[model samples]
Target: MIKAADLPQTLAVFPLPGALLLPRSRLPLHIFEPRYLQMIEDALKSGTRLIGMIQPNPMRGKKDALHHIGCAGKITQFSETEDGRFLITLSGASRFRIVEEITGFSPYRKCNVIWDGFDRDLGPEEVDKGFNRHSLMLLLERYFSARGLSTDWDTLKDADDELLINSLSMLLDFKPEDKQALLEAPSLTTRRETLVTLIEFALRGGNSEEMMQ
Candidate 1:
């Protein structure tokens, strides 16, 4: 079994938009692009087999800048398709802060990441005592109705606090910046709050693009 101490400081990052891979969660990725396909091949050869999933910064001027915070996930499952694409599942490991981006020979981005303040990520699953799951479900009902989205209600209801929020945060059709807010949230409680706020904002017909401006 790999421990946090075994994790490397330098990591390969996948700068995707609206992709949130929280600790203890699983993220499914389809690698079709040439750079990312190469990234998977190289990661499979590495010691940790982990990849940091970060989002591009949402600034209007700095379009290419990557976010400072991201979650690192272990490549727990990997499969190759006949069409020369990769189907991979990343099991969330820890959240890391980007110290700096490394200019490397590889086509994909790599970074020196610090896991200093995210010890909680590697610990046991977080418990949010005050989370109103019912209330959130009510809002989600309306929010989903507004967007014509459908989900397995029973599965969602059965999930614990951390899984429910993190899964919703990742699966929801929110703006990349809104998803970033959920990723950077310090705790499960805070993330639920952010999720609710986004749902309410959407219910009120508040456009995330307009908010980003």
Candidate 2:
């Protein structure tokens, strides 16, 4: 776990909607865009290999229009490909709220972030607080069948509660807003409840577009 003092105050952000990374979870990214390629290079060169994972507001056309909260991740794995693209995996370090955006010279945008509100993210994953995992699994079974998706239940059963919840929250085809809500959930219990509610709504044939509104 990274110490709060060691975390950077300012972070280079990747505004890719629907790509969610929770603390201690891993997210793999393919860097093909010139600006993002530059961002990776700068991250590698500098000691702080941290990058902010944020979502751009779809309703806004401005390049910098972003959600107020995002998670910071450190480059844990890196490999450069032959075509000049970088294949990197980030291990989430902490969540932050955007204090302010820094007007900088870099092609990619930077922001001054505050991690005070999410200090727990730096600690170990919380134990399950009697979250209804069985109900979630039942909903997932129905949801996957409805979508014609197959999964290895055997492998899934081995995952810890935190991994299971975070993985599902990140991998499911939920709306960007829904994903953001999960990311911003104050506690694991709350996150679990929110996730179950979203799943239940989807199972009941609720329109995601309507739910977002």
Candidate 3:
């Protein structure tokens, strides 16, 4: 396990919207774009293998404006396909806050990141007190029914609280801003509540755009 002290001060960031990677979670990505391919090569050669996964602000123009907070993931699985694309899985290590953007040698964006604020991510998952697991499960059933989604109930039943929350938070088709809100939630309790509220609103026939507003 990588400690907070081992994390780098600067990180190469991938500005992708609606992609959420939480600490201890794994996100698989396909690197095909020339710039990102170069970024992957550089990371492998440099042996950092760290990439900050952040959401881009749609309100901003073509510029690479990103959310302040993001999770830094280390490349745990890497393979090159026959067609020149890189298939890799990143294991989330820690969350970071962007102190500032810096000019970098690589075409991909780089930012000076601070990990002190999110050092908790390096530790074990903290269960939120007073979390109503039953209610959440019930709501998830309704949400899935309404969305016509199916799942393996047996497998889902065996998942721990943190995995359940983070997996749903990432895999659910929530708006990008809502996903960002989930990522920015100060604690697991708040994140759980926020997710429940969003599901309730959806059940009430509220659209994501209105809920966000």
Candidate 4:
């Protein structure tokens, strides 16, 4: 429900590594950390209710701890638990580029963001011209079997192109760097290709997530 123009120049970001949220998708978060809990409360009071989900790339050093590209998500729903923790869902709005880190304000990290070149994110759902559901499903089945993971095949079969690709991209157990690669993919087709490539790599005796830097 957030327009591209409505996206603020500055945004509070959740720098959690290995968490990914793409446009039109939803990310569920359990916030217990004092800073993040405060962040949730502050976002509730703000007009946009938007929060950027970024990955902390330690390999990049503190000056570039957070990956430059991240997605801004709107806090669509939230509930406070008895333990003072918050269970919330963020609906992905649009991807952004961090212009600079805004320090010295709140406990959580804030950054100036640039929303240019992401207009296509707000439009209708993208159609993957090269999406072959059957192939993907076969690949997923083998991948799941190898990992001892289970999924609802009926549901996945029913999912559309964008949902199928984006959901898998968000939910897969890829390394933070691989997930970042998925996030930075220019289009849905590219994302799907990247995902397929990752899966293929994993199935072919590639290094495991634990082995990656």
The Cα local distance difference test for each model comes to 0.90, 0.88, 0.86, 0.92
lDDT of 1 by residue, 1-213 (tens): 458788898999999988889999999999999999999999999999999999998584675798899999999999999999999999999989999999969899999999988888888999988998899889999988888889899999999889998998999888988988898899999998888888888889897766556
TM-score, prediction 4: 0.95
Candidate 1 residues lying further than 4 Å off, grouped into runs, are 58-60, 208-213
Question: Candidate 3's residue-wise lDDT over 25-113, tens digit each?
Answer: 88999999999998888878765688999999866665768888999889899999999999999988888999999985778999998
Q: How many backbone clashes are present in model 4?
A: 0
Of the two candidates 2 and 4, the one with more favorable lDDT, higher being better, is 4
TM-score, model 1 to reference:
0.94
Best by the lDDT measure: 4
Each prediction's TM-score versus the true structure: 0.94, 0.94, 0.93, 0.95
In model 1, which range of ten residues has the least summed lDDT?
A: 55-64
Tally clashes: model 1. Answer: 0
**Model 2, 1-213: lDDT tens per residue?**
578888888899999989999998999999999999999999887776899999887666776599999999999899999999999999999999898899868899999988888988999887668876677778889999999999998767778889888888889898898999999999887888888888888888896677667
Two-way lDDT contest, 1 vs 2, winner = 1
Query: Which rank order by lDDT, best down to worst?
Result: 4, 1, 2, 3
Which ranges in model 2 have alpha carbons more than 4 Å from their true place? Answer: 59-63, 208-213
- What is candidate 2's CA lDDT for residue 79? 96
Residue 188 of model 2: what lDDT? 80
Q: Model 3 — which ten-residue stretch has the worst lDDT?
A: 58-67
